[model samples]
Target: MDETEELIALCARALVAQMGDVPGVEMALTRNGVLGLTGAPSPDFNRLTLGAGPQAEDFLISSVGRARARGLPLVVVMSPQAQAALAPVAAGLGLTVAGTSPLMVLRPETPVTPSRPVKITRALGVELVAIAGDLEAAAFDEPRDAIARYFDVCLTETAGVEAWIAWDGDLPISAVTVTPTGDTAGISLMATPPEHQRKGWGRALLTQVMADYRSRGVARFHLGSTEAGLRLYESVGFVTVANLSAWLLPAEGALPGRDRGGPS
Candidate 1:
């Protein structure tokens, strides 16, 4: 695999590891794919990651069966190359295209100063889990309870995940998570509520996280970005490495709530 492909794989593995222990979630690793099963009623927790190879289609088919048997929605994450190779196969299976995001990576570079005064601090213990849910609810405009369920399962002590929140005075405005896998640190869930946009909170939060990770000897970082977040990430020296497509099997009856689908 090339540099971009390698980074994508590393990020995918880190995500799976972070979410692997959700109470009812089961993760199965195949030779060319990884499947996450959230045995609960919510479809938002289930995920699949496709690796590069001809077995991509077969792996996806098997994942669909597993998800269906448990009555959960299947969200498939695949790189541009893998998506191209599986397009015809996915078409035949009648899967719906949910959304797509650009995968970005940042190698060690000169640090950029934040335009605003923002203080970022790590969230420890249960505070970390609560902050994660709260940030997602505020950023996505969803119910806090629904988002909390995800954090409750995914943010344990052994999950190898760390969360940080950006504060303006005593109020928290932005949040992000960093997970280390091999030599690469995957940065994800960078979020700021609609009311706080354009104030440099996102940039400040990311700059702090990047600096902290770099201090720990981590030189590489990866994340998938939405259209609204693309500019902020680019401002911090992140470049597009690949485009990732998420194919969703919409659940019955309007689907519980809106899922950001890809990484934030």
Candidate 2:
């Protein structure tokens, strides 16, 4: 409703467009392998949908019904107006709702202006490897070949949100992506393997991710995070700047997948 909220909404819409076209885990198709307009084909569980829209209203109702009927956690994000309209629809279907409003965390030009006390330094071996279609592995139960081919279709259609694998050894444990938003970077789909978490994998990965972007003169960092991630980002020098939350959860509800690192 305010200026900041408007900015968040704009950023989220941009990300949805970017991620939806990619049709990766976060933007996967359903289990039935239904041919989405994108033709990338994801599991029904990994549906990529628009926020509540006039054209998408009936489709959202159907999605909410499907989620309730199947007991799967169906995720939908949209504008505030669309969210409000879908409220009754969600409630009508007995679906639990939550929303992790998107927020912008700005980095000051002079982050090191005033020197602090002893800085907490840790040994973090971080590298940003750019791959055209690195890890398109099946997020659900599909075979690797099928998922990769499907993802390739999405990658071809998308102009933003290229994949980046964060690796420690030969194996990639953590992964996150950035979708271009004009001059800004909208970070999305961050994940770490279950066995690899709590070892600062996410922290280290995010640190390097931002550092890489900053070096390129990327101004504002845009992202939508769960509540748990708020604290994590704050520790990494991110400030609460805007709200792009949808009706995925309650206003005070926790963000999703703060604990589960890999492939949500």
Candidate 3:
């Protein structure tokens, strides 16, 4: 694949590793894109990230239908590369633009480090993994149960994915996840709770993680950045590759067949 396509594929692979086996989740690989449904209340977990290809429209429509069938909201993540080909199709399917983020790739350089280093460690055991999930949920204002469930599966079983957390003595301060695909690695779900936002923990954890991964020979890194995170990422040498537009399909009020992590 070419450079842009390779970055997109890294995103797809990282997403699949995190969501593939989260109990009530379902995933489908289209001709060039990926569809994921977590059956969670949050739209963040239900997505269709399109790729640049002839079948992009078909994959989008079918993915929307799948979400509607389950009575859930769906978010379609489209990069500028795919928007020319799929935006009209998404509009025809009744998806409305919800938000936009930047898709970024790290430049070839040492990651930026915080002036004062903080203790950061890989989330190795079940308890630490669960703590990582808790921090993520708080950071993003997502449902705790659903986020926790995804991280539990991701930390316990996903081979390519790994999580790290910054700590203050015995308490956790920030968390992030990384998934390596060949020389490229995808950074995701970086979190620092509201109370801890101003501290340098996030920068510390991010730089340390990237540097450690670099030591392991991972030459490139990519991530989708919220407006709040753009500066932080750019400070560490990540350049915007594409503008990612998010389109949302409101829920139809149909209940999911099974709600994972909730009373059955």
The per-model lDDT (C-alpha) reads 0.73, 0.47, 0.80
* Candidate 3: pairs in clash: none
State in Å the error of residue 176, model 3: 0.5
Deviation in Å, model 1, residue 219 alpha carbon: 0.4
Candidate 2: tens digits of C-alpha lDDT, residues 168-225: 5556666666665655676755655456667776677666666666778776676666
True lDDT of residue 107, candidate 3? 62
Maximum-TM-score candidate: 3
TM-score of every model versus the real structure: 0.87, 0.55, 0.91
Q: Which stretches of candidate 2 lie over 4 Å from their true place?
A: 1-5, 12-74, 78-86, 89-95, 99-104, 107-158, 241-264
Best by lDDT: 3
User: Residue by residue across 93-123, what tens digits does model 1's lDDT show?
Assistant: 6567888888888876645445555788776
Ranking by lDDT: 3, 1, 2
Query: Candidate 1 — which residues are off by over 4 angstroms?
Result: 40-43, 109-117, 253-264
